[model samples]
Target: MLRTGAQYRDSIRDGRRVWINGERVNDVAAHPAFRPLVDIRARIYDMQHDAATREVMVATDATGREVATGLALPYAKADWYAKRRAVDTMMDAFGGVVSRLGDETIGEMWSLHDGAGVLTSIDTHFAGNIQPHIDRILDQDLFHVSANTDPKGDRSKRPQEQDPDMLLHVVRETDAGIIVRGAKYETAAAYANQAFVKPTIANWGDAKLSEYAVGFISNFSAPNMKFICRAGFAGRGSVEDYPLSNRLDEIDTLVIYDDVLVPWENVLFNRHTAAAAFIRSTLHRYAAFPFLQRILRFADLLIGAALLNVRQTGLDKQPAVQDKLVQLARYREGIDAHLIAAIETAQESPGGLCMPNQSLLYTGRLLGCGEMHNAIHLARELCGGQICVTPSAADFANPETEAWLNKFYSVNENWQAEDRRKLLAYARDLMNSDYGGHRLTFHLFAQSPPYAQAGAVYRNFDWERSAGIVARAAGLSEAVDGRKEAAA
Candidate 1:
């Protein structure tokens, strides 16, 4: 059933134990920092019921029950349906709010973990801890955030050798649940959601397992779960200055879990190293493909923004501008091609859920990182100094500056300077903000490290068969006479 925005809001109103700075937030819905994200998510929920978006965002479940794209797509046909669902998610994110709406991404990641859990006993942790949260959230169309990577004090050492608290660990276990202590850094959007899931990345070894292999879901407002939001861009000397400076895309947070109690139901993987590894690997694969698709969609927007800049500045007719635009188009087309290839080569899991071809999917991830970087750089180059010099929205309202801006900033005869400037500013925000940087970081982080990613591609590929065929053809060229050989 499609949930109303009000229903979704009311559902998450249940008291949570979230803390921000030093104060406890009584209601996330009422908090200023969190409200905008909630509003965005509410917009997504409302889209499920919208006649325009319903076809794309809503799908029937395995039981033939209607569910949101979050629930339905992971189990979908691994084809255009799955790809379309991913596109719908990115479109809903608007300004790439997933950094704040990390829960939605993690929720989808957990679905893959859950499917993997069904495959091996090693996946029990995911089945127990992560799957329940996914099921619950999917049923309610609940939004969530996630924190995964730890702050390694030194890159050379493993989790056990590092400060125990550097990585979130189960410090104490009680009848009620486990008391988790430590902090997870780069925890995107933890402050804006009802709850956040923490999944173990990869298990380094047995001894480190207890300290690193814990996975669970916790309410953002859970006791001792403190959030220190990264300072946003454009902070003025005044409170009002901060608002204008803060972009909606800056949703990353540092989540400190100070002896936070996570109940049994929330404990997805507790010291089960094997299960932890499988859950991590499976979720990584499952989420990465969809994430690549979303990045491609975002790239499309960046392309559109760049095109707008070119048209607005009358650079559309310039040979240089046209060349850059064509280059940008090729980049976008390459990404789209990879996405189509991944979808076309998709396969079904043993559990009957369809998934993209991992090889093609990872190729998309590689393309996503490089293409986005190029897109952003080309956009800046195309916009030239206008992107940097555009007056603030507030400046346009000042009568004195308004007249000058109107006279000087106009790009075309028909459009006012302020209007043209506004378009450029929006383009600048899309390509130049910290949020823009975060999007690039996300694409880079989506796949395993470059070497590992290349290795996966090489190892899984069938080069041996092709090599054998080539070797046989080469041997055939070296003729041997059977009777002569016997005489010799």
Candidate 2:
């Protein structure tokens, strides 16, 4: 069932409607803005078939079918380790970070799989749809993405009062399936095969059933699905100056659903606010691990850029500079420690799948995302002012001023002018470019906002044990343990 790179490319050429920079794109795989990421994604697919990486990237299912390791269901700790290895291998192959790939998005389906029982309790009609889709992703090797954020017309007015289609809703149901009308802000939607579309944060009020409470898997190439993507960072500058920007820009899209039909099998839930609420609360339960892992790798890039900058200028000998480098190292280790601990103490999910420890994972997410801006600033400071004022690669190549540029940029026999200029250009793109700023914002809010992260930690952390310990320390009577039954 493992697809080749060519087959993967052929799947997305199904005439999906995609527009970027006010022009219609006939082939997303060939478009300059999307081609880099598309080719990287394709290479990941090819890696599964390559002799060197086939062992790490592909795994056998119970049925003896070979599947992409990234999409396989987790049955044991080894499964998790394999999945982690696959992600690491893919990133290593790409030479930069690309977050919206298949591994991160597939976990959303697993999260829904964990909630199958709760979904069944809410409505028995659609409970059976969860596992099949999860299996479909594995068997088909599909590239899946997520959709949650929608443009709500007004904060105060409800969807019913204002534009009804502000939030995605089920306008009507047909014998074939349901007709949905709305839009979602999704990353990698234009080139992706499918998206698990769902509602954003919604206040259901007292109503048990609302039209806004809907979740479905939509095919990207389906009729009336339009992908309006943000202008890509690629092709904005020479690749020599903006290497990371050109190679790793994951273009986001506004996916518009103009009365699209969702087949009955694709409907995960409908008209059940409780189901929607349950999903919203636990949406990132499985996905957060991969999402945070990307940030962890990014921390390495930050530390690398800063340390190289300091070393190139002989600033590493200074105590203050060394201390700053240590700070960045500690930040990187903090992310690593949480990830290691979460897996070591992994908990079993209701669906009989192993999950990263909920408490550590959520708190880890908070720590990694909450202080990223500070870490970036520290890295920027350590990289010094040269990263901003450095001359371009073109200037170094020009015969007119090449000698002067070389004389100033060269530090020692070991640190030649060309290497120094390359390092500075890399540092600038990693920390100071528009791409750098966009990355900061993505990590901060990609897995919900900071407040939501804190909320997850609050809900998952064990408070009853601490409450009991405090009660015992204070010598409270059994009747004063803050129990309603004891008070009664």
Candidate 3:
């Protein structure tokens, strides 16, 4: 079921409505805003079929059918390692980072599969769709993304008090399926094939069942879907001046459902408020691994850019510069350690799939995301102010300014003007440009806000065990010790 790059390119040309920068995008695969990522995504598809890279890119499902390595359910640590290799290989081939590609979002569905017991008690019919939908991903090689947050206008009021369409909800029921009317702000909905749509809020306000507490699989080809995307960085600047921005900016979209029909078979949960809470709590159980993994690569970028900048100027010999490089190194290793340890301590989900250790995932995400700005600042400091003041690629090439720029930029025999310009450009795009700011903010809140990320760690951590250990050490009252033991 491995898809070729060409096949992936053709799949998104189904006349879906998509707009960006005040213009309609007739063809997402060919449009400048999406084409770069679309091509990278296509290359990911092609990797699994290429003989040289197939070993790491393809995996055998339970049925022995070959599927994309990233889509397989993790039943063992080795499966996770293979996925790591696949993501690494993809980034290497594309020379950039891409997080939303099916690998990261697939885990949201996996979380639902683990929550099947909760769904079954809520509604048996919708409960049955979990495993089958997961199987479909492996069978069809679907380019799946996640849909969680809605526009959520007027946070002060409930859905009933505000415009209910602000949050996605099931508007009506028909014999064929449930008709949903609302919208979601999805990252790649315009280019992706499908999305697992669900509630964004944690509290249902004691409701047992509500129209908004629904979860279902949405197809981009469904009727009345509209994609309103933010302006992308790809075509906004020259690749020579903004390499990372041009190559790696993933255009995000506000996807409007506009009364689309979701078949009963595609529905994972319906009117189960408990299902909503359960999903909110566990949505990133497996997904966070890939998200956090992407940050690891970003760490490499920060370190590489800063180190190259310092080395070109012979500033690396200084003790101050050396200390700063170590700081970047520590940040990189910290994220890498969490990724490796999460797999080492992986546990089986209730639905019989292996998920990364929860504590490590949340803690690592917080560590990486929480300090993203500081890390950027440290790297930016090491890069010096030259990155910000450097001449544009155009200025460097112009005959009038070429010699003067080269005379000033070129350092020794090894570091030429061109190489120095490229380094500064690379570092600038990450630390001083519009794309740098966008990405820093993106990572800071990628999973959720800081409080939410800390809350996840708070809930998943074994605080009970720690409390019980303290009880034993302090010789607390018998009741307190007994309660702690019972809870543990």
Candidate 4:
């Protein structure tokens, strides 16, 4: 069932408590800070119904029911291609990148669905809940997000030793379901419908039973849930000056679960440390594909901003400037190559779903996110100092300063002052503004930190293949192969 834009907006207007900038937002969809993203999300929903986009955004499931293309579980290379095309279409439509849309978050459910074996081994009842929820999201066309990071009060002290609520845990079980307490740092939680709440810390450390090892689907509008969001960047400046921030600021929230209940059907895994550990290791398996795709799009924005600035100023003729542009192109294509290569070498998940090549995907994530700062710096340098010193749109329009500003900002016949001002303003927001800095930090640490990214690469890479090659090259003993076999 494909949902329309109005339906999607109505779903979230359930009077959920949402706070931003120390004020309670009565209508998140109407609030200036959130309205832009909310409208974008709504437009994405509407795209499914629009005749031009319906074919690209909607697909038929196994049951012959039409659903959002992004929510459909990928079964073959064609399915992946369809999802990729759908995402590309949406990004093109929006004219900017915005993650945390339903497409990106739905993959978390697929990751857990792949872990049905682990879930079943722990408890058959737990395993039964996976597919139904997967169907529920597609059928209802709901917006889902993820929750993992919890405020671990002290790294050295355990939850029992310090504050028990530091990490989200099962407080107690009730007739309906289990009640959970604590919080999670979630992006788009205020506007999103549900979240796949789970443990962020992977290590259980020999304890067989732990309340911390719990996973469940929590409704965003449920009782005791509070979405306290960080101040938004939308209303901070004129749209002409901070266009991306105004339209693309995905407000992160500290979602407090004040003893929220999770119905039995909603609990994917509870008090099962093995299942929790499995999920933590493989949580981003499918999700990271879309996550990395966003970075690739951002790379395009960086390159475009830099090239436009250089071209407008006629600096593109310089060899040094061309080298910088080439470097930016390489960065963009590097991410693009990884994405295409991963899909080309796609692997089948244990649950029979097609997953992008894990090794390539993880390595690409590290490359895309880890080196984003350098790319941003290069783009910023290429845009020159003009981006920072450009006067506001108001100054250009002001009768007192318009002529003088125009005289200085205008470069040539084709390069007018208004055009130059707009380009610099865009470049600033993309590379130098508060929104730009926040985006960089998010790319750095959103899907775990740099250290964890390295760890994922280590865990997924084919070490045995390398080991066998080195053993043959160096004429080493067969012990290395034996050790690899033993490790496997």
Candidate 5:
């Protein structure tokens, strides 16, 4: 069912296990570190009920019931729609800071397991891991976080080769469920979510370590689950000292599970090695699509901001500045063009779900990373050092420096120097601050390494047929020779 923003908020407030630092967080709905994320999630929930976004955020299920798009949409179609909706969502909210968290960004990942059947095989492991969570989370509009990649103590070693605890695993199984003991690092929005879904990065065998391979969903407030909050740029100082962007926190965290009990119903896949494998493949298959939308939206914002800065600084008339602006516009168009291409080339899977063309999606993903970096660089170059040299908001309130600061900082004759500087500062913060840096890192690390990502693209492509076409064009086909000889 479509959930209202208030319902979503109240559901999370009812009960959930979440910790910040060493203390148990009694009130996540009101916590400084988590409130911003909650606010963003609420906005997404509100969109479902809004007349304008309702069509995109709410869809009719196979059962013909109106449900939250997050729970009702099929994975393939959902993946495509999610990317489109994400662009609108980001644009509606101002930018990535107020945008939906990545975890919530791809809610249809759960739907990938809907028809995968039992999780006894290794190939189906990933689906097995997620199936249970899908059922549990559907009951309420819960914010779900994923923990798949573990902090491998040694980069070269596998989970078994390294310290067992280096990756999360189930230590024991009871009639109630399984007991998991280990830590999951780099979990996005852990404190803001109601439940955390744990899945193995890859499948593993050996009954002794099989628990580590199991996938399950558990309440964040489940017994023994601890949240160690990561440091945040905005939370480091007093509100007066922080920038306007500081209030919107997107902190990475470590989820410590010390013998946390997950009930059987919550178990999506348990020691079924095959199911775990399928989950990973399915996730990898659609991983690039969402980021493509995010990058496109970001590019649009960057271009708009750059144009504004140019006008504000009276640099629109400068040849070099205009050229830079043109180049930036082209870059934005290039990324967006690829996204459209990917969508146009989409195909349906065996399960009758639509998925974006893999080759085009990967190309867009890599291009997105480079484009975002370049966009930021262009903003900096066009804005000049004044982007960073602008005084703090506090300086405007000071009686002594106010007038002089305004006079010198003003760029265009008609624009108030203080107002122009403030706009530039906000843009600069988006381009220069830790918040900006985190987005860069997220894009870089979102999927596998660039080389691997490219390799997947090549592997998925139908190159043999293209090669055959070239061979035929070059008269290299034996059938053509045979026909010519017969005629002679």
Candidate 6:
């Protein structure tokens, strides 16, 4: 089902208790801290219905009903391409990067669908719950997010040993369902409608069964839920000076679930440690594609900013600057090539759904996310010291400094003082600001940490192929090829 932008706005105004900077937000949709991102999300909903964008953003499902392409199960490489194009369209429309939007989060459920066999082994009812929740996302056009990491008090001791509330566990099972109490660090939960809550990463250590192993769908508007958010970047400063921060800061939140109830149907997996572990292992299998795509756009932003800065200053004529620009281009296209090759060699999942080639997707994630800081620093260097030392918009507007600032800032007829000021301001927001640092950390650890990302690359890489090639070259035994045995 397709929802108009108005319906999307009305849905989040359900009076979900939200707090930012210790102040109660009466309406998240209009609050300064949230309005920018909320408006961006709402515009995406509108894009699904807009005449020019609808074709890319909306697709017909099996029932012949048009639904958001982000929520649709990816059935082929074309579906992956469509999802990528839609995200690019949204980023182009909004002129900034905002990850954790519904498109990126819905793929978490697709990972679960691929692991339904594990759920079936634990409980058939749990297995039955996977697809419908995904369908409900499309049917209601709901905004979805994922809740995985919890503020575990101490890693040294288990929840059973220390405070049990550290990890979200099933408090007790009622006839209706399970009551859960815990907090999750979710980035986009304030304006989102629901989340797929699961155990914190690798929290269930060596336990065959535990309450902390539970995973369920959470309704954001449910009673006893509260969204306590960090100080937002939007209301912190002038939009002219901090354009990206004011418009694209996706405020992270510590969402407290004060003994909320989850209906039986909403309970995805109860007291199943293996199922929980299975999910943690393959959580980003499908989702990482979209996540990597965001990084690619960010790379473009970096390269574009650096390239323009050099051109404005006439430094592009020099070979040293050109070399740095080449490095940035290589980084951007490295990620681009990975995405293309991943789709080109897309693999069919055990669930019969087509997913990007696991190795390329994961290695691409590492390249895109791991080297983002270096890329940003390169952009920072290319943008020059002016990005950090440039006067604010207010200072530039001052009667005392306007003439002097313009005289210095203006490079040529093509590059005026105001345009130069805007570029520096944009570069500062993208590189040197608090929002910039947070985004760096977000790309570093948002999907998982660097070790885990490398671990995924390790797990998915075809070690046997390399080994088989060496064995054949060395005239080793046929026993080295597992494929031959399988063929027989």
Worst 10 residues of 3 by lDDT: 479-488
Give stretches of model 5 more than 4 Å off.
14-24, 51-56, 74-87, 94-111, 114-139, 186-188, 192-211, 235-244, 272-274, 475-488
What does candidate 5 score on TM? 0.84
Cα deviation at 19, candidate 1, in Å, is: 5.6
User: Residue-pair clashes per candidate, as listed?
Assistant: 7, 0, 0, 0, 18, 0
lDDT ranking from best candidate downward: 4, 6, 3, 2, 5, 1
TM-scores for candidates 1 onward, in order: 0.83, 0.97, 0.97, 0.98, 0.84, 0.97
Assess the local accuracy of residue 207 in candidate 1 as a C-alpha lDDT between 0 and 100.
54
lDDT of 3 by residue, 1-488 (tens): 78988988888999999999999999999998898889888988888888999999999888899999999989999999998998898888866678789999998888998998987887778888888999988888999998878899999899989899999999999998999988898888889999999988776897898999999999899988999999998867799999988998888899999999999999888888987888889999999999998999889989999999889999999999999999889888999999999999999889898889999888999899988788899999999999889889999999999999999999999999999999999899988888888888888776788999999999888776777777888878763564556655
Over all chains combined, what TM-score does candidate 6 have?
A: 0.97
Model 1 CA RMSD to the hidden true structure, in angstroms: 5.7
In candidate 3, position 29 carries an lDDT of 97
- TM accuracy, model 1: 0.83
Q: Which pairs, if any, clash in model 1?
A: 17-221, 17-222, 18-221, 103-144, 103-145, 122-275, 129-268
Report lDDT (CA) for all predictions.
0.63, 0.88, 0.89, 0.90, 0.64, 0.90
**Global lDDT of model 5:** 0.64
Quote the lDDT for 360 in model 1. Answer: 76
